[model samples]
Target: MLYHGPMAVYNELIGQGSLKEDDFQRTIIETLQDLHDRLMKYNPEPIVRDGKVAPEKERGFFSKLSKVFNKKEEERLAKEAEVARRAAIPKGLYLYGSVGTGKTMLMDLFYSSLERTDKKRVHFHNFMLQLHGRLHKLKTTTHQHEDPIPFLADSLAMESRILCLDEFQVTDIADAMLLRRLLEELVVVRGVVLVTTSNRHPTELYKNGIQRESFLPGIGVLEENCIVKCLDGGIDYRREKKTFFHSAKPKDRSKLASSSTMPTIVQDSSTILPDTLVDEKRFFWPLGPDTKKEIEMYFKSIRNGFQVTERRMNFLGRELVLPHTAGPIAMCSFDELCAKSLSAADYLTLAESFKVLILTGIPKLKPTTLHRNETRRLITLIDALYESQVKLICSADGPISEIFGGGSGAHSIDEDPSTMGQLTPAQRQMMDDLGLNDVSQVKKSPIFSGEEEKFAVQRAESRLIEMQGPGWGM
Candidate 1:
């Protein structure tokens, strides 16, 4: 195979494990290429600069250039020479762009192709989290002189010569402060080439924060030590959605829908009969401008007989399991589930208890975002799910991660708006003006019993009689 670019040669070597680094770099590059191919297929518009799908203007130029470069012997010598030159180079490459522009894809490709003999790729968020965990371990340890960061560095340095980080955003105050020193020790002092992708331009990184100026020199060092490329297609790749979701079977859809039986109101309480089951094939239903109370009522009714799955599969091929079960019932609205704001623990508990969590109505959460608190909770949630091996089924406007941008406690959330941050006065005001903020401002007086009303009337009459004529109630 005649591999063309520097990346191609690197990939070829790396794939064979003949490269000096380990598989981390090779994996990263392959992941990037995978992401690019996935995006081009799933997204309605272009994100990657498809060399095959070049503009009309460039085709003629390429045709003429191809004729000039048709010497097989010369090309072979040139490719070898170019590979040698790149291998000897000590510097790295920098990719920066807006979110979803495939900077990550490019970087991943680059990282994957490199010899796994000495490469590493990590998400900035994950890297910091690991570092923090190490720090925590060191702090609790009995050894007083042991440095956590140095311990981490020792591990990192053990088998990697090239490091690649995705979403190189520095927003955490503590991370920002320590980042300069960490990179210095890892890349500068250790001579490991560093590669990264960022949403913000390097000059604008760590912008307008406490002592941000201090990080500028480090940014300068990065600028000086790398080949920076800004692939600005001036297109919002994220806005395009070729498909709402993956091709799902009916079983998959049913797995996400509410399984509860519709409960009937008896006197003051809602009760679901044991025999009731809801047969809702469609997993999601959109709600109009609905109130929280309405959502609550809906939740109450559905949970009554809540045995959609259990009832449906009452018997196996030859065995009878719930032989007394009758028929399927109506589904309860999921409006309440999405409306009720939950604590991290509660959400986690709920996730553990239920096989399905149907979130109906316009999902208030954008998959692309999580608040700082949400990010932390979500990361914990993801970790918990991974450990528990639980699958998440979300029916939303888009993909779960994309809808809420991969938020961060490590990277500045500002770089990714889907990240958790306090809303500004202006933003809050906008929401308030639109009536989106005060969702519960409107209310109706509680409906009272006829007997209760009569009791109040009788009490008022008795009090009036006592005040007017103390002698008798004729």
Candidate 2:
């Protein structure tokens, strides 16, 4: 068989009508192809930490004699070789852009084109979870003075010299602190190639984090090591109605994915719920007074009531009791699932127990600090359902998009003093001249002001759209 690279694969996909042509994606793909070519010829070198001596390599007769005869000179030669090796290491890409710009798709293409087996691809969240798990184990066995980074980095780099991560983000301080040293060890010391994607730039990572000043040095280390590029101003390709998503059957599980490959959303229209979403089969919305009763009817319609009873499931030493339950079908409220302090694990357990879930009373969560936690939990729930191939039926505040920030956060900015200060004098004058000041003259986003919240909301919207298929249950 002839070897086909990512460029060929991308073009093939476009030709097959699986993808549409976009100049932005093309340019990014070209760069990735170059990196792929570089990776094919690349060879791994031994890890060499700063101020620490590198492990000696086997030498020939003359070189081994020199090591015994002139220990100092041999050490000097070793240091020089290490420096050269570091310089020769390939600089991987750090692609940053808004959601739905095909970053992950391009990454997948690159990954698929790779002929090597040493590379490992993972989601950023799962990677962090694994990292934290390793750290926990190391902490238990090792002393406080012993740093766990070296062991962890070595283990990871040994498995994957080329690490391709999607949705790279930092939400907390511990990750913010640990990531810097971890990257330094893996990329700088171990010569690992990091090909990662994010919605934020290197500077924008953990922008709202506590004690963020300490994390800046890590940013410097990351920037100095990788080729950082922005893949923005492109359409969100996620909203496009691929037949694979809209037409799958519940029994045809092979035709479906365990989870949504949702990364970006794009349509000729920007509205969250397009006409396509109206009266969707698996996903229903627009919470009215009768919405609850309607979903209940649909639930009972799935099967004539067969001894419905609620039960508690054991999870991580705690019991989570779900209400309104049958054998493979369960029912709960949005507040019960999301409004309460439930976790992704809890949602996963819920998904595993039921083939179909009916949830009610989802609200229009305004994009603010207050709604951040609920929105995050909702996203987690959706992810678990999609991952388990569990079907979800629900009635909500509006369409999936309108669930957060109520579709648009547009309001009158002229009346608010804080908002007026944000506009230039000329801009304000123009608004006044057009009599638009009284209207939505200044359309500020009613969504999250923070990047983290915005990213999560967008993710939820995209996934919710795809989950409305017949093959939602496995």
User: Best by lDDT, which number?
Assistant: 2
Full-model lDDT, candidate 1: 0.42
Each model's TM-score? 0.43, 0.73
Candidate 1 displacement at residue 50 in angstroms: 46
Clash count for each candidate, listed in order shown: 33, 4
Q: Return the TM-score for candidate 2, rounded to 2 decimals.
A: 0.73
Q: Which stretches of candidate 2 lie over 4 Å from their true place?
A: 46-72, 142-145, 242-280, 297-312, 324-331, 348-357, 369-372, 383-392, 407-449, 466-474
lDDT string for model 1 (1-474, tens) is: 754333564455445443333344344444444433332233111222211244556458777687577778678888897666444436566677554344554564454444355667766656776677666666688335654555555556655666777667665456767676666655554455677876667776666544566777668767765667675554432233220111111212211111111122211133323222222122222334334345444445545544444322211122212212112222222232323333334434444443323333333232222332332333344333322223232233333333233322122334545533444343356356644443222111001111112222222222221212111100
Whole-model Cα lDDT of every candidate shown, in order: 0.42, 0.68
For model 2, how does the per-residue alpha-carbon lDDT over 1-474 read when each residue is reduced to its tens digit? 765577887787676655677788788888888888889999986544322466678889998887688988879999999989888788888998876666766776787677888888876766776798788887788534577788888778878899988778887667888897898888888889999888789998877555577888889877987889889855654565552232222223223221233222212132221122323465566777577667877777764445578888886677777878876778888887888778766777788677668888888775442455676788778766765556678788777767776533222222455653264454456456644543332433111234466676676676676566423343
